[model samples]
Target: MKVKVAKTAGFCFGVQRAVDKVYELIDSSEDPIYTLGPIIHNEEVVKDLENRGVHVTDEDSLEKLPPGSTVVIRSHGVGKAVYDKLDGLKLSYVDVTCPFVLKIHRIVERESAKGAHIVIIGDREHPEVVGIRGWCRGDCTVIKTSAEAEQFNPPAEKQVCVVSQTTFNYNKFKDLVEILGKKRYDNNVLNIFNVLNTICNATEERQKEAKSIAGEVDTMLVVGGRHSSNTQKLFEICKKECENTYYIQTPVDLDSEMFQCSSYVGITAGASTPKKIIEEVQEHVRIKF
Candidate 1:
């Protein structure tokens, strides 16, 4: 069997930078270190951090931190309120929010200040979207699907600005933006609509590469945390191209039987997935072959 692995798979720039910052602090700081959340969606990485005394805390737990504790903001940026709360607690924080996500926050903050209703195209519950919403000075909406896009009905006169989660499927973002363009709120929605494609360049490349590989392979394996949005998007894109697609968090999740009849297999991982995990999965598949 021939095995294909995406060159773009695993740890995009932002995730790598966030992970590196945490490790650096772990080595240099004697203070109690906490991440606002899991540094990345990957459970393996989070568990490793926990082993190294890097505890995970939420917004509600800011007051509970010990004096001199340092909070590390995860790659998924937090809302401005988080900063205020951290300040109120007098705790120091390291902001490792992905630059792509930070850019979206800035855009939302700027546009909302100008009175445009901010519309985010992503899962509402996603930390990044929630953070972006917190930056809006006025009203904000989160739309994740075509149905949501169809059902969206802001006031006709309210100018609307749209941004997407950095990990959102690029094609779907376009489709949703197209749907928004057709909505005739007072027959002037198109003129007032400001759509920004905020999906990161690395995510687009990974998805594009995954699609091409999945189309040519007999089976495809997408590796990442179950909670990872970018990984889920990759699985979706790959499944459409090849029905024999599996989403696995680790090499342990792989079933040798799945490859029994496969002549070619493609492997890809999410942005938060570490290169070691990807390598292990690849090694397991090669052993099976």
Candidate 2:
């Protein structure tokens, strides 16, 4: 059997930077280290950090920490309220939010301040989307499908601004935006309507490459954290092209039985996945089969 691996299968720039920041703090800081959440979505990476004395804390847990403790914000940016609270408590912290996500926060904050109603195209419960909503000073809507867009009804006088989660599927984001655009036109709401494609270029490239590899292989393996949004999107894309696609977090998750007679296998991973995990999966397949 032959094996092919995606060049874009591992950690993207933002995730890598966030992980590096945590390690840097661990090495240099004497105070106990904490993160607002898991520095990245990968469990293996998080577990390793935990073993190194890094603790994960949320908003409710902030008060438990002593005043001088250092906290590192994860790549998924938090709302302005988080910053205000941290400042109020006089805790030292670093903001490691992805640049693309920071751009969405600025857009929503500025547009909503100007009286525009915010519309975010992504999972409503996602940490990134929740953070973006926090920036909206006025009304906001989160829609992930055409049905939600069709059912939405904004105030007639309000202007609208549309943005998306950084890791949302590019094609789905476009579809939802088109549906919302038509709704605005049909209602004859001539207010200032703005649409921003906030999906990161790395995500778009990874999804495109995953699709291509899935089409050419007999089976495809997508590696990443189970709850990772971008990895789930990659799995969906791969599954559509190759019915034999499997989502695995590590080499241990791979089933040798599945690839028994497969002639060609492809491997890809999410933005948060580590290169070592991908290499392990690739080597396992190449050597065992």
Candidate 3:
């Protein structure tokens, strides 16, 4: 069997930096450490941190933290309210929000303050999208599909500014944006519509690479945490190209029977996935098949 792995597979820079920050805090500080969310979406990493005395805390749990506690912000980035709350509570925090996500917050904050209605292309319930919404001072909408874009009706007089979730699928972002562009023209609101390609370059490259690899393989494996948006997106892209694609968080999730007759397999993982997990999956495939 021929096995191929995406060059872009595994932790991107932002996730790796966030994970490193947690380990740094664990090694150097005796104070109780907490992450606003799982440092990244990977459960294994979070469990490893828990074993080392670090803890995960959410907004509800923030009030319970004693004064002077240290918190690490995850890469998804939080809204302005989170920072305000953290400050109000007098907690020290190391912000590890991905720079790309931080850029979206700044853009939305500025544009919304200037009377632009914000339209985010992403899952509404995602933490990153929720955080971005916190920055908008005016009306905000989340659209995940071309259908949503078609159904949306922005006030003709109000300017509209569009941005995307940092980890959103690139092709999908473009499609949604294209649909919105047409809607803007049809409504004669072209002059007031602005589109910003806020999807992270890492995400774009990873999806592009995964798609390319999937086309050449008989079966594809997407590895990452189940709750990871980017990983799910990768699986979506792979599945479309290779119908035999499977999404797995670990090697144990793999069924050897699925690939017994396959001559080529491709592997890709999300940004939050660790290199160790990717290697393990690759090694297992090599030894088992």
Candidate 4:
């Protein structure tokens, strides 16, 4: 069997930076350290970090922290108020928000403050989108598909500024933009239709590479946690390109049914996944198939 692996799979710049911050703090900080969330969505990585002393907490859970503990902000940057709470409590901590995500926060805040209605093109429930919404101090809406963009009921045509969550699907973003563009119906035009390409370059690169690889292989293996949004998106992308694609969290999740007749395999992973997990999947396939 010939196996082709995506060159850009695993540990994107933001995820790598966030994961590194947790490990570094776990080793250096003597006080109990907690992350605003799982740091990233990969449970395997979170479990590993837990074993090394890092803990996970959320916005609501922070109040339960024993006094004087450090709280690490996850890569999905928190709003100003959340950080201010840590300051009020005099908590020692680290902010490991990816520079790319930070830029989106700034963009939404600036645009919203200037009176442009903010629009985020991604899952509303996703932590990254939630964080982006926090930065906008005013009206903001999130829609994941072109149909939702069609139904979006913002105040007026030109009053909206479209921005995307960093990890949103690239092609989908372009489609949403087209949908919004068609809605600028006005002699009554709301006067300002702003579009900010806030999707992270790393995410775009990974998806492009994964799709190209999936298109060429007989079977595709997407590696990362089930809860990882990017990983789930990767699986969907690969499955669309190659119907034989399978999603697995680790080597343990691999199913032989996916490889029964496939000879050419392609592999890719989510930003939150580690390189070792990708390697393990490749090795597992090599040995079994």
Error of 4 at 120 (Å): 0.7
What TM-score, computed on C-alpha atoms, does each candidate reach?
0.97, 0.98, 0.97, 0.96
**What are the per-model C-alpha RMSD values against the true structure?**
1.2, 1.1, 1.1, 1.5
Candidate 3 residue lDDT tens string, 146-250:
789889887777899999999999999988888887766655556468899999898999999999999999989999999999999999999999999999999
Candidate 2 lDDT, 1-289, residue by residue in tens: 7999999999999999999999999899889999998888999999999999999999999989976799998889999999999999999999999999999999999999998999999999888998998888989999998899889886688888999999999989988887777766556756556899999999999999999999999989999999899999999999999999999998888787779669999999999999999999999998987
* Per-residue lDDT of model 1, residues 144-234, tens digit only: 9999998988666778999999999999999999898887454555447888999999999999999999999999999999999999999
| Residue 108 C-alpha lDDT in model 2 | 96
- Pairs in clash, predicted candidate 2: none
Q: Kindly report the root-mean-square deviation of model 4 from the true structure over all alpha carbons.
A: 1.5
Query: Where does candidate 2 have its weakest 10-residue lDDT segment?
Result: 184-193
Q: What is the lDDT of residue 102 in candidate 4?
A: 89
Off by over 4 Å in 2: none
Off by over 4 Å in 4: 186-191
Local error of candidate 2 at 196, Å? 0.3
Strongest candidate by lDDT? 1
Tens-digit lDDT track of model 4 for 1-289: 8898899988988888888877887777788889888888888898998898888888787778987688888888887778788877777778889898889889888888888889899999988888888899789889998789889766854378888888888988999988888767645555467888988888999999999999999999999888888888889889999999898889998887888888999999999889999999999989988
